[model samples]
Target: MPARPPERTAADLLTTFGAAPHQTPRQPPTSAKRGRVNRPTAPLRGHARPGHGWSPVLAPLPVYQASTREIGGLFPLLVASPMPAVGARIGYDVQSGGAFYCHPVEWVLRNGLATNPNIAMFGEPGRGKSSTVVAFALRMLNFGVRTLISGDVKGEYTPVVRALGATPIELGAGNHARVNALDLGPLTARWDTWTVRRQRDELSSVLGRWVQLLAALAESQRHPPSVSDEAALAAVLRRLVGASDGYTRLRPITIPDVHRELASPDPQLWRDLRYESRHDFLHQLRPMTDALANLISGALAGMFDAPTTVAIDWDAPVQSMDLSRLRSRGDTAVAVALTCLGAWSSLATGLRDDGDIRIVVRDECWRQLRLGPRAVAAIDAELRLSRLEKIIQILVLHKLSDLYSVGATGSQAVAIAKDLIALCSTRVLFGQSTRVADDLADALALTGPEHQRLTGPVNERRGRALWKTENHPAHLVQTVLSSFEKRLFDTNAQLRPTAGRGGGVGRSRG
Candidate 1:
């Protein structure tokens, strides 16, 4: 029904559709730039949505906690580094968020805080004492420090020694690994060759150590040797040592040689002695000879009665004399063997450079102290000389009480043990029983805080300990071991799963 539209021309279509005509141009409409939409002055108000879940809540103003730094701003003394940055790191000083270091040789030398280079560490079994020592020894080894562990009581250090590519000398009744007390393997580097005086002094020291060991053995037998007996023994020792000189001295002197001299005194020496004196001397010699025979030809033969089959590897990082086998041998036998090993280790170090750092670790040291006052004196002397000899002695024991327990309460032996404890300038105290802690506090003169810390709960304190050094504040340290160290230094591997025992002290859970 609509009327028909006419066909549009090309010009009309181009003009209407906004195309430029053939000769004329068409212009486009100009537009102003659109402005940004302004936000509403007032926020869209419905339920007033919160920026975060807590924002819209009409709660009391949040009570912000003050930081430790803020709190210490009011108490200046409360802010300071808990540990000095020196020596090898052994632990963490949580108080100052710093690494704790305890290399006695370096710390003391740098701080001028100690006169002796010995360190004493005590803890209950499984409290991480052995692990800590092993970690320390490993670190020290990196510094070219040689460690000589005299008594590996449970073979706790055997693995570490082996890990360091060292050979541990296992001593027992018939192990064939003997350590002759008289073999002066190497003299200190100071002496290019042994001078007569040096040789005499070395022999005298060996003789003195032997006398103390023998006296201790006799004391353990309930028949302490008399002064006269010691005098006679000393005479015999001097004669044998004097007769053997030059290349002949190379022959290792054994306990049997001294016994042989006593059994058959030179005719001239016998005639020189009074008749009653001679009789008493022979009587005293009987017990000495019997004890000597037990060591050489009796049950305890072949270990110490001959030359040492194993020589100390001066280049080895660690040399541990494994005494785990000595357990079956009675306490006296073990003590005697340890004494000989210690003597050998000492002399071996003396044969090296005085400036060279050497570590002598005495584990289960209470066993040696039990020998007698004379034995305690010998140890005391060793501790005193450690500084000059460049020997850092690490004495590991159960607790300070072990020292006093060596002899009768309040006896001279007890006094000597106390003296020995005093000589150690640095001490590491791990978790101990309340009774032991109390005793240590008194013996060490620990402050109230230190005493409390030492008596902390067993579960919370395994690897945590209080470290004290001469003229330095005691620091509460948490021993930190690397994952690798944990696997090598752990002593409780038998009880813990492989990965479970990877952390040394702090990582060990209750």
Candidate 2:
């Protein structure tokens, strides 16, 4: 398709609006107050591209007029009569003012599968990463926004569940809740949820990696262990197990665990494998039990299949997931707990009918998205729900490098997301200042003091930030803070890991 004509210039815009370019005198809505509205000099008066006139055919949608400049340095993609970001066009709102993102109408109407397909936020501790974003999602929800919160960190979202009156659907707790992986039971009541042909089609392709991985684990456990021993064992296991049963969340088969399982029942098979060196490696891999757990929970979250409608009782307070217990736990264990939380969040958001479901997939979420083997890929793809499913993921991660350590391959993490919110768009240099501010000022295509004014000041204060919009250079904006910021990741303070099943492990919970 041909491109739309070049966007209109400022002068062309002004002249098009006619003599009173600031006040076009549009018909005010019934809700409009006489003094509150800013009558633009004139309607958008720019000529269309070479082919058209008046209403620029190529222009994106618009936002509503605002009483005052609310938030700053955000893309005012959708425009409105003299309003940068007003009303539903609003995005972030701090005490100082409100900022607009895309027009709500456009958002409601558009496919939402644009270049930036996922929502993202990043900040150092205490910058209100989850808390602030939760409230933001709620505000959108109250206005009947369609979204879902697949929470990566559960504790950060309790405030959100409460503020929105969303019910707590905890596994092993709520009546409606079932403590199982992927919440798959609810996907289809009947046994044949998937067609026979579909299942068969997926068998050879989808189950390949999963079966191989499990087989490798079993092979590593043999006693005499020839170099080809483990491979031989894996071949045997693959011949016996089927995908449907093998891929079940309940069927956890880790590498070490596989060795342990093989060592039992079939003593000769275990002994013939000559697994001494591999056993030592297995012992060293003890700490990874938690990492395995994290992978499990993540894989599970990606498996939810249900009616996708959750009704909340406004009278009851929302219950947030308590991660207060995960502090002292091993880092990998912490990651696992978070995966459980994300699974729950995704499940909750996938089913809300009354409002948007804001699933905040933060912290180590890239782990699940990164693991691209068929089983895990299917999980991620399903949970990365489409518009038909009311789920909007707010992925939060610190340095982009962390995306590397995650289990999956390629740019699966970045490829899955839709939008990015670069917080405090700043730089560090002499005396703890940065050239990013200068670059931001220059990039708004600003030359004079105005750019300096917007990108000015580097404060140590929390909740205050700088950003840039399509129209101009980066600037500062104030926002509310979340409770967990500075308290969790950046600080030493931690939560004890939640108790796992079985009593043989720890003396007591931390």
Candidate 3:
């Protein structure tokens, strides 16, 4: 090895090549790290020297600053993913370009995305509010969730009900169908088998609902009942149901039966109500009695006074109560019919077997609120109980102002009606005029972008709506319906000239 040319070191080679060595010198390897490999160091940056490789210039990264609002627009999907396709596939998410699905119960119970299974839908006329609701109900049918249109004022749901192979129960002056406001429905079916405590609780609930219904009915006639009137009604309901006497069996009562009890002063009821005498009790509750009498004999005559004539097929995919006949009577008449149907439906759907979920649609629900605070209370109770009953109650309104119209400014009814907006965790807002859109934005705490989207020209198209589920970001959705669904949910058949000529629009089909 001819004097072993002093083995050249790595540093000597770097100096000979006119390249500077790394500033940090490598240390001798140790037995503990013998097999470890060293990572290469970054190349030095500077002007190139003779025989040295060129060092590329490095530029500083540009730091962009913008508000989240601006950034969200730039990267919408990155900001938030689309809502899971968990429920009924009603339409498409306009923002994320994904299919949109909604099942209020599933969203609340299974997904934990909502706190309640109630929804409030608002829209201007011809904006497809009704169509969207019908589409949701129809699609949810495939999920084994049934639907009940508590009060269909326009008979709009009739075609859907029939299409589902079930006849809708029609109620009005000339209609044969009857739904007693006091009918207990399925709630009291197992009363005898329940424990005493259960019976007492059930009785209290039954009486409370009856009294609330009676108060609303009385208010419809412009006679909002007094506190004493509610007490008398509760007492009478207890007596009629045999709950006051600790009886094992219960009795089913009708509106007329309640009216009869109120008309003929019951001595025991007067005593229970702490009245001095029958004459005093009769004189004090005169307005309530007169109101009940008017309901039995006036516009609502023969509609809700008799026993329930229509048998509800609980197992059916869908059921609707047609109240279009009363539309000719007046708004007030239709409202009273809605109040009665709401109460009847609440009782019918209250107690059901577990896993039996139903969607209850309250069309023109503002009319029910307009009755007075008591009526609003009745609706409020139903909304509150939705979670426990496994019911998804959908209230349809033409505008948010409809709720404010429930009573005078700052009135109790207005307060309750306004609070109704909070109870519904899901709110679907359709196309609105400039004024209505502004009010909706303020009421819902919608952002500037959300408000713009609501009144935007894009929302003007039919079936376009803004769906706000709880406190999550709102979704712009365009409801998609099949040709069959379009024909099935078309409510403008009467307005179309072709309909008069018996065109496909007017032709009845499932």
Best by TM-score: 3
Model 3 vs. true fold: TM: 0.83
Per-residue error at 9 for model 1, in Å?
A: 86
Q: Give each model's clash number.
A: 3, 66, 0
Off by more than 4 A, model 2 = 1-116, 143-154, 163-183, 188-194, 198-320, 340-360, 363-390, 404-510
Q: Rank order by lDDT, top first?
A: 3, 1, 2
Each model's lDDT comes to 0.70, 0.37, 0.82
Cα displacement (angstroms), candidate 2, residue 126, comes to 1.6
Q: lDDT winner among the candidates?
A: 3
- Model 2, 1-510: lDDT tens digits are 999999984435544444313433444444344454454322486544563345433233233332223211123443332224422322342223546343223333444313222344434444444544444454454445543333323344444454444544432112243233223222223225556664444333323333333322222121122335334334334333334354332222223343344333244333444445546434433333233333334433222222223432323333344443344444433444444345444444444444543333353354433332321333344334543454444455433333333334454433333112222112111111335335434433545654444334323444444433333333344544344432222222234343565322211111
RMSD to the true structure for each prediction, in A, is 19.3, 15.1, 12.3
Spell out the clash pairs found in candidate 3: none
Query: Which tens-of-lDDT digit does each residue in 1-510 have in candidate 1?
Result: 998899885445445545434533333223243242242223345235554233232222233234444434434555465345666678787456578876677766665766677988888888887778877887787677878888787777877778777788887745678777655466323334677677666667766766765665555555567786777666666566653344235334667787787777775444544425656657756886666656676445677667768987777888888888878877877777677677677767755754788888898887877766666766777898888888889888888877877678988878888888778988888888899889988888888877887787332856777888866778788888888877766666566455555733322211
